[model samples]
Target: MLEGHPWFQLEVLAASGKSAGNKYRDAANWILEEEMPEEVGNKQVEQIDSKIFENAGIKLIFSALPADVARSVEPELASSGLFVFSNASAFRMAEDVPLLIADINGDHLALVEQQQKSRPGYIVTNPNCSVIGLASGLKPLADNFGLKSVFVTTYQALSGAGYPGVPSMDIMGNIVPYIHDEEEKVEEECDKILGKFTGEAIEPLQLNVIASCARVGVRNGHLESVLVELETDATIDDIKNAFTEYKGNKDEALPTAPEQLIIVTEDESRPQPVFDSYNGSPERARGMAVTVGRLKLRGSKLRFFLLVHNTIRGASGCSIMNAELAKIRGYI
Candidate 1:
């Protein structure tokens, strides 16, 4: 979608290994072949020859490969001097590497200068799906009001499990209690995305994160119930002001960016997957903004419910926005 921005026109030079197919490749092909034309018939999107990006100038590469597969391809792309923004889990925890949520920590890009030691590639990884929603919602609080810890229960979407995802028979009318390594990823990634960068390395926030993950029947969006422990004193009104009055790069009116990063709702039974999943502006709330509702204050802790588009903002949309931010900062 960043490539579709008013100022940016992208000619995708893409290829994939001979196999069933990858989730990213499948989705990109859908955008390139079906969705783009229906959305904007005048705009032209073409697929270039494989070697064109190698010989011709190329700005950046977004890797959606599985973690291990990304490890090998990333070096080659970087060796070619292409900036990489990866959604894969590989290198996410690297000391010198950056785990970015453009809204949360674009400063982490400063560490890109250190990529010279590794294949001339600078990689930035987006956090786990569950973490993306939690991190973005907490970022504003962490910046203005201090966040000390968070406990979340994620009702994740099936797509996060990947293509041929879960068996229908198992999930048709059921909810699975556990997802392998998912809780760990959510626990670790939230801190990383909300962490502090020391110029050369990132020190994840001291916020203690505990998570419980479940697989739900929803086709899109991950909904989380969060309990945040705050250090400084704050009231329900203060938290509401922080979220409702929020504006971001999307708000400042970046073409592909969402207008708000967080949306706080007063409706007690709000942020339901089927109901609010598609709310908000064209690109802003299409699962991009972290929808927070059911705010309640108990002592120093603030509790709320959140919903985020898993495949878009949490996954592909977040990656696209990061690339756009990098372009804005000239990192691409």
Candidate 2:
């Protein structure tokens, strides 16, 4: 995704792979199943260090580190003037750090300024995979009707657990009901993402979010069933129109931004990883749009099924788009 960006260039490929001293091609096999494109595979894999990034003239970074690793590495890099667009859970709930979905909450980017007052650069974060799916589905509902309560059950993809994840012996044909700390993240992060950013910090939207997360054998997309009770009366057409009409808060077009932020489908069996996972338009925007289907609205109660590409929309793509928004907003 980074290689195809019109504005950003792939500078260095940094990782903790054993092939640290070798080209990215040496570690590509261990990471992705697809053939590594020559675009970035030829870059040397280097150990992640603030000084090394500075020496390489690197100013922007896309971090997909483990939370434990990011907790230590991210601040050091940001302190040294590197914009860290992180996918890790570390610092996501910090008062100053924006748990951002740039299209949903461009206002939250204001927190980056507060962060920069203390340091040369700052970190921006995207929520856990399931939270991304659930939050995307709830944004229009909460905005138009005001959510009184949200209940979600997520059938999350195996890839959300990170590479080499979910041992085959346990997850080959079985669904793991428990994913460590996933439920809590989904329940907590949504309010913050849809929160009101007050220039200094985010005032989390006062709504009760209850979520149950289960890790399924699916490869990529996260499929969630959501039930929301709205604060006002609304018909089915009203709800559907609100969802279809949402253009999001992103003011301008972004290279990685999808043509439609949310695509509402009529097919009952849609949103499956095989068909709807890559629902976003244009080659560059693939997997970046959330696909919602099975909408059933009865008075103030609404139920729907939603899908988001866990790795793309939920992780890397989110951080990439946040950087693009930051660049347009002059925060980068």
- lDDT of each candidate versus the true structure: 0.75, 0.87
Q: Estimate, for each residue in 1-332, the C-alpha lDDT of model 1 and write its tens digit.
A: 54445654554535454322333333343422225443333333333232456665665777788887788877677777777888998888887777887777878877777886765657878888888888878877787788878899999888788877899998999999899888888888877777778878778787778999999998878999999888899888888888866565442344545666687777889988877665556654366777889988999999889998787787877777777777777676
Q: Runs in model 2 with CA error above 4 Å?
A: 30-34
What is the TM-score of candidate 2?
Answer: 0.97
For 1-332, candidate 2 gives per-residue lDDT tens digits of 87667989888878885758998776666565566778677889898888788888889999988899999999999999999999999999999998988788878988988889999999999888888878888898888989999999989988887778888898888888888998889888988999887768888986778888888888889999999999999988888888888887646888888888889888888878889998897888889999999988877788999999999999999999899999988987
TM per candidate comes to 0.87, 0.97
lDDT of 1 at 317: 75
Please list the residue runs of candidate 1 whose C-alpha ends up more than 4 Å from where it truly belongs after superposition. Answer: 19-52, 117-119, 248-253, 282-285
Error (Å) of candidate 1 at residue 60 is 1.4
Q: For all candidates, what are the clash counts?
A: 1, 0
Question: How far off is residue 178 in model 2, in Å?
Answer: 0.9
